[model samples]
Target: MRNKLVEFKHVSFRYGDDQPWVLKDCSFCIYENEWVAIIGHNGSGKSTIAKLMNGLLFPQEGEIYINGQLVNDTSIWNIRKDVGMVFQNPDNQFVGTTVQDDVAFGMENRGFAREDMLKRIEQCLHAVGMEAYRLTEPHRLSGGQKQRVAIASVLAISPKILILDEATSMLDPKGRQEILSTVADVQQQHALSLITITHDLNEVTQSERVIVMNEGEVWNEATPRDIFKEKTALRKIGLDVPFVALLTDELREQHIQIDNEPLN
Candidate 1:
């Protein structure tokens, strides 16, 4: 059996002591090197779940494990080193004035030597296809470019798992495509476990596993093909089929012979 990289055991969380649970008994396991997508509507606890995975938040009633080690204050710093996160807004995440500086910030914070930091920064920028922008100001870069820089910053540390919380939501269609291509490149080459939280069905269609959350629980867990086939069930929970899936459904209705394989 494959080793589990992240685990949540009856995990639940709320923002305040008196508030109701935002996530309730949210238990799931992500394996080493797997690509997983968490889908849900606004206020459905998807963000909360992502925070828990990387130790940004701890469970109120249960436990979370990273690389088989239980996450607590004692182990959170180490766990954070192994798990990297990229939040939605590109502007908010950019701290370095230049692209190179931004990519090296995390390594610098971790006390890497100057020589090693530069080397890793170069390699990471190249990996994300942003080597040319090394000396450019981050403000001059496009949305997609900034996202790649954010990714490069995380990659410089060689994380075992990456969490993207709608990292592409603010980009244009072309920009989103560019960032996703970068994401594919990293996942393919590094075999890094990825957890992407997005409203876009297009993003989840490529995942090895699909998880749909509703009202703070795991409402559905299945392959993309299986989940898309149950359109009514998804619609009931305020989710829509992927545009490609809907188009395929329409064509199949008219007797078109299209392969119904899950899209990537």
Candidate 2:
């Protein structure tokens, strides 16, 4: 059985008393080793949930737990140790001049022994297929290559849960594919729990489960196969289903049977 790595119970958040709630009564759980995708249009509160989970923001109501410990100012530091986040802009996340230094940045902050940092840097860079680029400067690498380095930096810490907050949004189709493939390999090799916050339906198709956020709430939760089945309902909320899903829905409507699940 998978263990619950993260949980939100009736969570609510707002910037201030006068502000409208950004997250309203949101609840969900991400289990260890599960790859879950959180998707919605802009201002859907998906990103807020990501910040909340890491204690970057605290809920005004309800509770969030990471690794069974409640998320609060006091516990946040420790919780973050178990949850690593990579954001959309690869350039923004890079702090090291060279790939090796960037990958070692996180471990260095955590006060890992110099020897340990070197070992982890090597391992993580190899894991992300950037071992050859260890001496390459961040600016010299492509967007996809930089993102892989960012991912490698996060992995150096060995966090149990990895959150990719629109990490692939800025990349081209090929770059996006490369990062997704890297993430899949990292997750499988390390048994890491993955949460991808995205607007892309293609990303959703790769997840074990999907969390649909709409208007500051969790509109629905189901596997990609089942989520795509509700094409009309999804479209109503200003979200587009994948092309394969749309075609499958059309075929099914025409009284044709799809033996295999669409876009699985």
**Whole-model Cα lDDT of every candidate shown, in order:** 0.88, 0.91
lDDT of 1 by residue, 1-264 (tens): 878999889988999999999989888999988888899888899999888877888888989999988998889889999899999998998888999999999998999999999999999999999999999999999888889999999999989999999999999888887787788789878889988898777778778888899999998888787778888988888888879888877887998887655464
Q: Per-residue lDDT tens digits of candidate 2, residues 1-264?
A: 889999999999998999999999999999999999999989999889989989989999999999999999799889999999999988899899899999988898899999998888889999999999999899999888888999999999999999999999989888888898899899999999999999777788878999999999999999998998888898899888888777876887899988876454
Judged by lDDT, which candidate is best? 2
In model 1, state the lDDT of residue 221: 83
Could you tell me the TM-score of candidate 2? 0.94
TM-score of each: 0.94, 0.94
**Predicted candidate 2: what Cα RMSD to the true structure?**
2.0
Worst 10 residues of 1 by lDDT: 255-264
